[model samples]
Target: MSLLNDPCATPAELADRCEEAGLDLAAAPTSSDLEAVGAFMAQWRRVVACSEHEPRAATLNALMLEYASAPWLTDHAGTGWHLHFREPDVDVPRQIAALISVGTALHLSGLGMDRLGICAAGECSKAYADISRNGRQRYCSTTCANREAVRRHRATRASATV
Candidate 1:
């Protein structure tokens, strides 16, 4: 499921990761800064994986600065039961981190810690939220499935030709 599904939960880093994965973003990421984004995504991968392995606030804090104060609640009206995590004016990164971290916490505690995962393709490293009825989604998309299938097919044919 798109992390944006949880309007309040989509943290900046998560949004960045989603953007990197070509999911969604308010603006297109600059190609020049891709390396910096890659660094953050690596940490984000750790954060998502930590829920199963070793979820620690210290580790999370090391990845990014902590929220300066407890996030306040704001209701934008008619948006249903969700909370805004930032002050009306704040840096986007901090705002995003708070939203994403809170969203992730809510997601893990409310649903289950095991609901997040990386795609299972051999060379793919995309993240995904298992929001299916059975929560069995593994690959990021059907394209990955097709690619892997083609790879295997080619390998089989190459061996046969040899």
Candidate 2:
């Protein structure tokens, strides 16, 4: 969701994001690749922002249909085999889209559809995928939580004085 949250407008920035995400890219991403990935992020943000599980599932299913290829097992390196849900020899952007779509599907199903959310802080628009054991996470981070808490406290104090 970082791509959707704070988008990389340039190819270099997109490369940095892929690096931060630890993606093994066969080649440097291009502007066209960045555009494709940005579009994919937009669709994913829709899935995350949906409050209902049924709609979220339908959106995810559509994304998987559009982006994901048939699943295949591979051990590209000498490591143990693992399943890849995308076609081989695609560009980095397509690969990342497949990964995100599949990962989101797994996350929502394994956890709960409500586990995906946008931060509740009024000023923050960041999206988060909740993996907490209790699955009661609301804020994207502790900073947002603290900020909201302080806002509530100050509001309570101001009301009491009135």
Candidate 3:
């Protein structure tokens, strides 16, 4: 979502964003890495915007096929044998893409594909993953919801006065 909202325009920015997102890169990002990350972000936007389950699943499957390798158990950093969905020694951008694609599939399948959405506020284009208990989230934040409510209230008053 961060990439969709504010895409990294350069290799340096991509490296920074990766670091910020808690990805430990084996080395600094390259131009190829930037291109790969940009492409993945575009695909991610499509996945989040899809309102139906089948299309979203298809997209995720394609992504996994292209970016992910066979799953493996690793304790690369002595972190106690966590599962990695990509092959060893993969580049940073490809690794992140694979992880995200697989994670999205799990999240959607477990939590319902409807949990992913773009905010309903007319002025906002933000994407959200609905983690709420009831899974009925519409707007991205309270501010947007409040703004929409105020607009509705004003419209009601105007209609009554007419």
Candidate 4:
């Protein structure tokens, strides 16, 4: 389980997290992978904006009322104490948005807003959560890192040749 904590999380799980964060980027996905990539960016933006702006409960309340429905409370199994933020019966979209709004607030306030970020690849635009020892992750994957290295090396060689 990624627990929404791991930075280098897998693509499949990333898709779920993206949806949970109110991202629906399947405008016309050529493939599932593209959809995943789009959703990841959307979720990343949401996390970044929330962290940077530090939205208040009232702001989230407005979003919930507009995009979602009135927030509700439901606890199942009662493992100690926790809140669901929305009724489980609510439609998936609203439920997801509500949770994303409130859950993101919790994550930013509890953790740190400087936790999320995009890949450092020259051309790639993937997102990450920076769970490193020094919290300095840059690239989305090893493939992107290699691609960037190749690009830089090729550019250097071309410049030398020129």
User: Which candidate should be chosen as best, given lDDT against the real structure?
Assistant: 2
Which candidate has the top score in TM-score? 2
Clash count in backbone of candidate 3: 0
Q: Residues 1-162, candidate 1, lDDT per residue (tens digit)?
A: 343222222344454665565332334334423344444445556766554435644555554445434555654454454556545555444444555656666675566666777777899777776677776767777898789889989999999999
Better of 3 and 4 by TM-score: 3
- Backbone clash total, candidate 2: 0
| TM-score (all chains, Cα) for each model | 0.55, 0.93, 0.90, 0.49
Q: The CA-based lDDT of model 2 is what?
A: 0.89
Model 3 lDDT per residue over 1-162, tens place: 677777888888888888888777767988988888888878888998989889888988999999887888988877587888888888878887987888888888899889888999998999877889999988888898899999999999999999
Candidate 3 achieves a global lDDT of: 0.85
The pairs that clash in candidate 2 are none
Stronger candidate by TM-score (1 vs 4): 1
Residue pairs with clashing backbones, model 1 = 11-100, 12-96
lDDT of 4 at 114: 60
lDDT of 3 at 94: 85
- lDDT on C-alpha atoms for all candidate structures: 0.57, 0.89, 0.85, 0.53
TM-score, candidate number 1:
0.55
**After best superposition, candidate 2 residue 130: deviation in angstroms?**
0.8
Clashing pairs in 4: 120-138
Candidate 3 TM-score versus the reference: 0.90
